[model samples]
Target: MLDTQMPTPKPRVIAGESHDWELVIGLEVHAQVATKAKLFSGASTTFGAEPNSNVAFVDAGMPGMLPVINEECVAQAVRTGLGLKAEIHLTSAFDRKNYFYPDLPQGYQISQLYHPIVGEGEVLVELGPNDQGTPTARTVRIERIHLEQDAGKSIHDMDPALSFVDLNRTGVALMEIVSRPDIRGPEEAAAYVTKLRQIMRYLGTCDGNMQNGNLRADVNVSVCRPGQYEKYQETQDFGHLGTRCEIKNMNSLRFIQAAIEVEARRQIAILESGGSVTQETRLYDVEKGETRSMRSKEEAHDYRYFPDPDLLPLDIEQAWVDDLAAHLPELPDAKKARFIGDFGLSDYDASVLTADTTSATFFEAVVAASGNGKASANWVINDLFGRLKKDDREIAESPVSPAQLGGILKLIEAGDISGKIAKDLFEIVYTEGGDPAEIVAARGMKQVTDTGAIERAVDEIIAANPDQVEKARVNPKLAGWFVGQTMKAMGGKANPAEVNRLVGQKLGQ
Candidate 1:
């Protein structure tokens, strides 16, 4: 999927005082592994627990409390690597990244630097419409995926001066997916993260919940001249790309894009003003809509990474990885393609339906129950989804089940009810549950398909609107007014096709 030769869109250039500059962006996403326990402790990994309640002795870094690797966390990391279509290393080791913070009781994070469980990978990011309204795609290269333990939260706003530490999140397993500097624009950066989140959510390796801090990204941005990126690609020189600044711990996608824009502009302004862009870590101030310096960027030597003494290097058989791969569920890309191919769905419809697994499952169930593909897709995407959004409900929390919605679609397909009648039936089924057929039959909501009834209704409409009928006869398109009035006069119970036919016939068209 790594399309190195894929023609990229025009570079996103920021106009400097003298020359234009292009943006080079890379993202390091930290996704919390979906597991029940900490990576190297017996502590609970549950969110919203009481402060310091989920900590075990190992997580607390107590004397003589040795760390124990959680096998499930390792499995989840390997599964994520496979899902990303990356190379999996048979042997990987953990290292102690030395750091000091109040939230980090261990004073050092156990991470992988020398040997990561997952190697390089590629993510195919689907960008939004270009200037020509044509959707473009980019394949971003992933540099590596390393497993690490998360630090606890440092709460600073609780008291007047004193700060508090919440250790509930400490020792939680995380997979740091580092990408190459392949992203060009702010939108592309967001799309890349979105694709990564979607892939991880599909894999079930990570929940991809940004609100709960289940996923966070550290974005590194650098600005260069127009053609410097091509030179860097050819020579593999770091100097070609400008000095990079790291934006730390961005959770929201919107904020990530905004931060990149402001940060890139800040660097461009500094460079244009005859100043050098410093390499440092920065924080995006949401209130100010700008990035502020957090600290100087640290290099590998600053972490003092060394192999963990307590834990041994992990070695797994290739057979185990293969087994995991075999048991993997259908991913988002494959599911989207299948939905398009099997259901004859548009790309947009397939993308919308397959954005999440629950929606896709519900749509498939609707298709199965209704025995109609296009109609089911229309109802699911247009009617059902619109109603769900209006009610501020998720598909999983829908009042109408797939079978019930499918039953409504079946009523329309069988010509038992008109489209207008189906909408009313949908409301009845949504608010007050019942069989759509039974409700339609009990309420006399079936379409009047009888040609005699439709002709009489059309004749009545023509007799009432003498002036409108003259115009409709002269302009066939204006006959739609007669069709609408006739259907309305019949309480929207008339079959639309029969109404149109009778309207055209009576109008001498």
Candidate 2:
């Protein structure tokens, strides 16, 4: 059992009220499990396939079909629990959550309710920079992580008169990780979800792709008197908690924050008017920036959860758990520490590099191959990352491979290429992949390392501009002008350090 002591609640600001309020928040993050096949069947889990094409017989709930457990999925869930430092139940059972929807072919979802696989995990979320640029980390306790099958998507935009169901996503495995009502604000909620996504991504259990609906959050929001939470903290009373409204299907971070803010204020208004806040499921209109009621929030009893008849209780041995734990990859925190210690990176740089596993791997590969830690980090974080953002490309989809990038850095380290020339070569590599050395040589973009050659160029520049030379001899500040002119004359292929040296030598400054 993790520590459950809550700190003194801070005051919250109501929209148009004089008295301060406290906004309490909790989140249910539904992360799509990264697996090759659906949870109960052998259907392909690939996204963007034709509708109904990826559905298996069990996924489609065909008559006479029986559900079979995927051992890999179970192992993946256990791996996630271990990563979260949570309690892994040796024997967990699945329950059937009955519901009706056009997207749900079976009219029930196979989920875990009675015995969740993982329990009582804690996530430390780093709230964005404060005014002093220092980040504050807040720990949100995770209640449990339970596995369930995903429903198909109901698309309503294909025709105004008809809605269509795409079963491509049906029966996909999802891990609903529920958090305690520990979040204090919208920013904290977003941070919690982001941190959870990062952990899942690091664990290799979830893709954490919000755009693909692979990762989404349901935000539970409520408000009470400023000091009421402190009372709950001391007493551990759930009744002191105000009624909560659940905002469903919030995928975008901006919209998540907006929905929470709007919903919290709405609750505050209702309570201030002496009307109790209704517990309901609400949908956020991204365009309108408001949340509207969808339906009354259903309780656990409403779902009538019971162990699935077709599936047996999931049981695993301690040895298998221990083996899986031993083979687990270095997680985000460890990787961040290693980056700081091994590569001499600051905490901020380490955080950025380790935010995603792919980017961190790419950075390490470039550093290892090129033997330029700081330089490689700079290029990867600044130049390559900027280009990737501009092109809307992921680090894994970067056109410039780690080897090619390392080769480019090596050329710069060996003084065979200038910084400007290296940048141009990078662009070339990014657009058209090739050997950096060959590209530099083919384009005659090598830096001018010969002192004699550079000296001659500096001399010519000085002879043409006697006035600037005289100014440099007097003030010594005008020497930068000659350096610029020399580099420009060399088609930006001049080594900047050599150019400055040669320019100062010619001007006698």
Candidate 3:
């Protein structure tokens, strides 16, 4: 929940010679529902399939074909709604949004306009650079989440003479999550989308893969005067915000940030030049780094939307919704809180683990197997995560498994292996995949815990460096040098604490 007492930040100000401008932004994120088939037909929804092969007759808009809704897709939307902490309408109907595209075989898309499946959710977005290891947070309200069918892709690059239509993406289920015009800047907009994607992925409602077009966004951007946003928030008046331009189908976060900055500047330039910003649709050209007008924006009336006559209004039972609610997983927010409270983890580490479901799951498994949450967390975050990221592998694709990592941490905890020895054991297990204890035993990686052996090693290092040993007696802080030498002389297998103890005893003499 957002703290109401905290003051909202100043509007996103773009300084100008004549005047300062502010930016207002909203996002309509389209997340492809994770279902086996299309929203309205039984067409396969597999990606990278043969072009037009998976599409069904209804998806192709054949003369006699009628749409019969896929119940599973509807359930997925409901699951997503619950994940967003949104309201699920018991009765919602689909409408035909009439439009023409070379790839849209139906010539109109089936979407929810008048009554959507979900309504009025809130997403708590955490702003990051994570300064001081704590992120600032704000609540971005969701206006609605509606289920709709996707349009096909028009491939223009493949044919220079004519464009090619691939209906492979056609008729896939999409959940268009519309947000309130609460975003004040580009970073916030990207964070909003990211938080939404994270939640949906946790729920298994959407894969949230923006690269594969599994997720995309239409960014609504406008620039207003500095204090106008506060007024808009108070009055809930759409007019208080300036004329917004819709930037279509943004997939990358970096590109989204750049597009917002460029578009805001464009609008600022237009306003400063004595021209009003136009309410229009625009395309972001990545290479040119500018937004160009695509077409005039249309109101709902222009689409001539009507209830999809072939399929009746979808009516689901509250009992079913309740069942889904009961099964909802521990979301990122809850999981993060638990990590901080239970494991004694820092806010930053908790956020990093819970950012993705797989990472959290892996961390928990390591904790369970090792019976040492703190050690497991450090190993997971500092060592395993760094290695996995360097290798460019997902958590699921890691060379080290939870059980294997757990065994290594266990050796460290039991004093069977020193931290330095554990690192060596980790490398061996990561590459060879064997028991940590067995590897430590076979390779003599065990820490030398005997006080007598450690004392002998310390005496040798002291005898070898008498001047340094005298300096350590003069300055107790310099005793760490003796500790290091003793550990090195013992092949780094001596317990660090015992080595420190022996070094201090010999130095005091």
Per-residue CA lDDT of model 1 for 16-68, tens digit only, reads 88989999999999999999999998889999988999999889889899988
lDDT by candidate, in order shown: 0.91, 0.87, 0.89
Task: Please state the error at residue 267 of candidate 1 in Å.
Answer: 0.8
Candidate that scores best on lDDT: 1
Candidate order by lDDT, decreasing, is 1, 3, 2
Off by over 4 Å in 3: 1-10, 129-134
Model 1 per-residue lDDT at 298: 94
Let me know the TM-score candidate 2 reaches against the reference structure: 0.90
Q: Compose the digit string of candidate 3's lDDT tens values, residues 119-221.
A: 9988888775343544466788989999999999999898799899999888999999999998989989888888999998899999999999999999999
Model 2 error, position 60 (Å): 4.2
Give per-model TM-scores.
0.97, 0.90, 0.97
Clashing pairs in 1: none
Q: How many residue pairs clash in each candidate?
A: 0, 1, 0
Worst 10 residues of 3 by lDDT: 1-10
Q: Cα deviation in Å at residue 207, candidate 2?
A: 1.8
As a TM-score, model 1 comes out at: 0.97
TM-score leaderboard ranking: 1, 3, 2
